[model samples]
Target: MSKIKLRPKSPVRLVATLTFLLISLQIASIIGQYLAHQFSIHRAIDVVERRISLDSAFLDVGNETLNTPANRYAIERYLERLEKVLEEKNLPVVVSEIQGVRTKSDLTEFPRLHRTTFENAEQTISISINSRNPLNEVGISWLSIILALLISPLFAFTSKKRRAQSAREEIVLPPKPRLVINLQEKTISNGIDDKVVTLQNKPLCFYTALVKYCIDNPNESLPPHKDVPHELMALANKCFGRLIELGHTKRKRPDFNANLDKTLSEIRAALDDVFTGYIDEKETYYPPRAQGEGSRSKQHSYALPSIKEDDIEIIGN
Candidate 1:
């Protein structure tokens, strides 16, 4: 019997897991540091408050009506003793900003810790605990961790949704070919597929004129038979005149209105030849055909509705 080995399919999952774990560990480390610093400060504050409440001088000061020099000296001596006791317990904090008498230890420049206010009938003595280490101060580390935790899952959800949407999408098809007409070369082409068809002088001029009219008046359609518009006729004559100027044809411009139907048929045949494999695109480039048993009196329009004005490029026009 042969053993079959199973391997993981995508490295993306593994990378994502590793990245998440790394971020979580970093956040946890920051939270742990902040908590540890808070616990130490709390312990130090508890010790100082307990010692202050037991002092006989602080109790006596509560009943005093005046904050005399002797009372201030007594409060100052009590704070010095409290500081010494905190130092013995390995707490790096000192009391400062008392009412009157200054202490030998001045830690005014350090980060202040929370302390209780001692108030008498005459004066209030509010002491501030200044810690030597800056890390004892409250910082934005906890706030940053909370924001990261909140935003990480949101980012992950959005990325997951995008991937699922992309997976459900179908393969995109190639863009349709543009219709290109070159009067200089007397050739019509499907710009994308390299399919080219050359037309005779009259048919080419008539087709170019029709394309130009469609570009200017996209919503309007020309009538079938010899009911060609005057503007269209003038444009056709202009194209024929350009051909004569270029020496492509020596014959004079023919009457476009008289030979309208024949010229339309010729244009359709040339377009069909150019788009041989792409027969479905005939409606885009071909002249509109008569529909559903229509008589000569009925309004049978000739137009290229599917082709946008920007898609049809007429060179040497």
Candidate 2:
């Protein structure tokens, strides 16, 4: 004989199982309701029957019959039955017992008179209706089952749709790119000349250098600069724009800005030192004066090396 293996139920199946349980519980509740209805109907009928039996007994005995042992015994039994009915119905019931002399006035009170005569007093029993709803001869358990059958499938379908949508989103969407900007260093490379420059170890490619060069010489362009890529241009613009925005802010932070400006000035000085061939020597070179003095003459030109089509390169204009 071969053994059959059962597979574990997945999440959807588990949800379906729970739905089935709910439907079963609802069916049970419906069955319970019908049973309760039948009980109520039976109890009401019993109460009516007891009241009729007591009336018949009173009719058989004479109205003038005083509180004799037999009469009292019958009355006591009636009271006990009425009490039991009251308890079962969860309410009060009133019944009237009149024992008097056979008078025309007394006879007017009850149309179907039984044992009325010249008597002493009246005994009263109040019959209060517990409820007006009629007996439920048929059970509606099948309705609950039908509703569950209809709604459970719909609920499962909706859940399945939601789960599928979530799965698709997980598969379709791309993960975000991680940005790690190390501002400590930067390097810029001129693709045309194969020259490279670094600032705090951050790369400053042709586009970045061009942006800086533009900032210094707004009205001029780099003579032998290579074409800038779109991505590089955007990055360079973002970097330069942040500094420009900081500089334009109205907030006063003199020392902070001063230090930042000094660092930038040093970077420019280093670039100038490199261009002037003074990067190798530890000493600063001071060009000879033209034997003249002016407010604007303090500025000195340091010519950048020029590249020609031939192998021999020219320096200074």
Candidate 3:
């Protein structure tokens, strides 16, 4: 405790720290000088602005009028208006003096018109505020803010109405149309004719009205079916020319004709079932094979395939 001693700081660290502190101080001084220079320039600009005003004095417009309190009041008002009018111009307008207090007269190159007047005071002045009125298509400039004020209400009313009417409305639905369908015949154009081929100046559907008519009058000496590949092919060709006629795109079942003939035979047999007189009853009971007194046997039913008129033979019967 009695021999406690303090160690000296390193010279290298002390020198480095001093160098950093000096550099920081120099940088701060430079920044301060730059800020001062900016401040001085801003002050100079302010002084220059103080020298001139943005508004202008009124000018004379009329020559035959007199100077009165009313006329003076008009001049002051004209100056205020001129100040407003000057705002729109690139080169600012500074009114000098209002002269010729009388009727509003024309002035050159300025929105306001004025003339020297004589009626009351030793010096009388008159001015005409620009009537930036829309005369036909031409417009006259004005210095007054009354128009701007008046239009604000119209804008506010429109805005409020627009806001109020912005709500969305639900759509109303209508009744559905009636629909009809047929299997044997097609009444609609979309049911057939995949290639949209027309026949007889109309689109040909396999089950369409024209096909039904053909079937109704098959013996009417029209196109035949055997030469054509399919049943619907002849119908399609009848509707549109052969060049544009759409064909039947179908996978004909294996031995389709044989199967169809077999089906037709079965149907013909069924129809011929009513022609039982063709068979002899005594021979139909059974053949002479395995004859017995108490014998049982199946009935031998027979029928013939249907024959068209062309296939029929003119016999003695």
Candidate 2, residue 165: the lDDT equals 65
Tell me the deviation in Å of residue 306 in model 2: 45
Candidate 3 vs. true structure, TM-score: 0.17
TM-score of 2: 0.26
Off by over 4 Å in 2: 1-75, 80-140, 153-164, 177-198, 201-317
Better of 1 and 3 by lDDT: 1
Can you give the lDDT of residue 73 in candidate 2? 48
For all candidates in order, the CA lDDT equals 0.71, 0.39, 0.32
**TM-score for each model:** 0.56, 0.26, 0.17
Writing each residue's lDDT as its tens digit, candidate 1 over 47-124 gives: 765565456444434333543444566777777787788778877566663543456776754466555676544555
lDDT of 2 at 306: 26
Model 3 segments more than 4 A misplaced: 1-4, 54-317
Q: What is the C-alpha RMSD of each candidate to the true structure, in Å?
A: 9.1, 21.6, 30.3
lDDT of 2 at 220: 42
